[model samples]
Target: MPISSHLSQSPEGDTFVKIRFLAACTALAAATALTGCSQLAGSADGPQKVTLWLMKGSASEDFITKFTSSFEQEHPDIDLEIKIQEWTGIGEKVNAVLAGKSKESADVIEVGNTQVAQYIETGGLSEVTLEGLRVWGSKDWLKGLSDPGSINGAQYGVPWYAANRVVIYNKDLFDDAGVKPGPKTRQEWISATQKLDKGSQQGIYLAGQNWYVLAGFIWDEGGELAVETGGQWVGTLGDDKGLAGMEFYKQLQALGDGPKDADEETPPQAQVFARGQVAQIIGTPSQAAEIEAANPALKGKLGFFPIPGKTAEKPGAVFTGGSDLIIPDKTPHRARAVEVITALISEKWQTELARTMSYVPNKTTLAHLVEGNDGAATMAVGAAQGRATPPTGRWAELEGKNPIKPYMTAVLTGQDPKQAAKTASDTISKVLSSDR
Candidate 1:
């Protein structure tokens, strides 16, 4: 998706937002909706409550408190009720609420950017294009965040923040091997890795079943895991382009000591990378803290760069992993919900959030805000080419019983790439094409 120039709210838009907030408060006061609202707001005459569901660890308690205090001060008529949710079985929990099975539903919910398709398929999200595009400059939103939220030209989720994989390398290891820190192209990367893959040092620790990393290589080779055709989705991992990506992965995996049968989580890659022998790992910048915590000895010795692409002109594509804000269709506080989203995505808050969390702001224009932070800046470079997973509600199911991992292990273990890819693609097709 081509990024259009960012559009900002005009003076008139400021008035419109204020009017919308007041109108929502008026409606809430007249309805006196839920008894729960009274308790949450602290009194019957308290501010109109707008409940929000935020995932645990999305923001720090300090950050949340600061934002909540500021937001409440700015909009005195609204009381923001935030509920922290966990990632474990979040899909089923979200489904229950969207299906109206839960006793209480959140007016606004933060969901994984890629997970928006599943919720959209449930027909439980309110359309937010008017606010997203017109009020906020969503036209300039990162495609990785915006693309998944939009399907068939309708928008249901507001892009909040994004994070993409970058090459986290050991500076000490690179110096020992006489290799440069940044390799602009894949061949250069491989050459450097070969030099660093000497005795007692793994050039890179890339788990065989890290399909998210594979997705980026596949995209770099101009292949998609799945694509929509005539209204039905089809898996394409068996295509020639995909096979080429797998070929690269195999070549790269040869330089690592990572296990062929296990995913990165089996013995967490961060822990593995922290042992100080591995030169690089493709991971989010946030994983650095974990790596440091495991071995505090390597605190300032780590370096980062965008993952190398086929060519030096741009960084390799990456799978964007982050959250988006969506309003449930059942929420009576749609107007207030949109208002809160607006406040969060505003340039002021976006910059603050990005700096505080070391996150990539939703807009490409805001990339400069994190340019001073090494990890975040490197991630922002990759975020330009970031892509989300196959935008299908069933994509999650495909992930649940992912055949790609086993297929990767099969190929890495010496099976023919074509045959392995074919088997995985067939499974992907069957899962994505299912109606259940």
Candidate 2:
């Protein structure tokens, strides 16, 4: 946390945010109509009201309903005020809250696990000791999964849940391609995709602008976005391994059809797939539910498979997309907030989360609950091999702005991969250095 009692916010700051919110309201509402605010009431004078800010999920209401009742039974003196927020513009809203723009403080909050490092470095989250978290068994978090919340040697967030991408393809398309149930290697995957590409129907939808998706290829080639050395950030995009990864990414670009310039959000990969024209997509389990919601007929036709890395022996490293639970330093109820986080990562809650939400639980041992299902089984393998960006606040800027998108576009549109890599490395270097 910052040394100051609180980060002061001028009235103008709130007004500025309001203006931004108003400008984006129409867009926000469209993407987040399913989201709304809610709260849990407690006795006026008895227990401290600990506010919680969590992003809305499919089973959010159920999880909150059950957890709130159980939590109150366990800690009678601490009442929870659950406030659900939308993922759209959540980072900025959280930034405003941490900067003290509003008087209504959230005692406990859920932050994107990748974004957690930015908050930790910014003093937006309270420092938590691993021993303190271990009392509740949070120390049993999945291998590399928990590292997103850990910096240097200190912990800042508790692993809540993860949603990693797995290949969900149309079984009918696979049959037409004369392919097996799933790919055993990178070569086989490409061959299968090419075979699946027929008249009017495409093989895949690779969102070129999605760096999260792009990073998987980079990681598979033993490359990374950036690396810190001698207390300085360095971009690795121009390196040999990075070149190899981008070349591999370009190879797939030839086997797919979509707005090559567009992202996963603009023409949502799932919504596009729901049309039944695309054969497969690398998406999270949430998209499986979304496919059903958008076009029910496509539900039974989908098959789940883990993304293989270079060879059948190695599973590809997918982006682990999810949130972590953290307490703010300015919150009045620190211990109570700890209790809330503790309850969230508890064995019972972890199991319930997996059973209801399709999220891979934080603990590796609890992954058995997810593996029974095909997509969850594939994601279980990914969670173990998953990788996160370097632990630095500047990383948030890189993701938020996505400087690599244009470079990826350049490569996909005919520029030499090496030339694009050099340009991307230059831009990344400048971005990282400017932050310092």
**Highest lDDT model number:** 1
Scanning candidate 2 in windows of ten residues, the lowest lDDT window is 1-10
CA lDDT of every candidate: 0.80, 0.70
Name the weakest run of 10 consecutive residues (lDDT summed) in model 1.
1-10
Model 2: which residue pairs collide? none
TM-score of each: 0.89, 0.84
Best by TM-score: 1
- Writing each residue's lDDT as its tens digit, candidate 2 over 255-318 gives 7776668777767788988998888887776677788889998768888888877988878887
Scored against the true structure, residue 415 in model 2 reaches a CA lDDT of 83
Model 1 whole-model lDDT (C-alpha atoms): 0.80
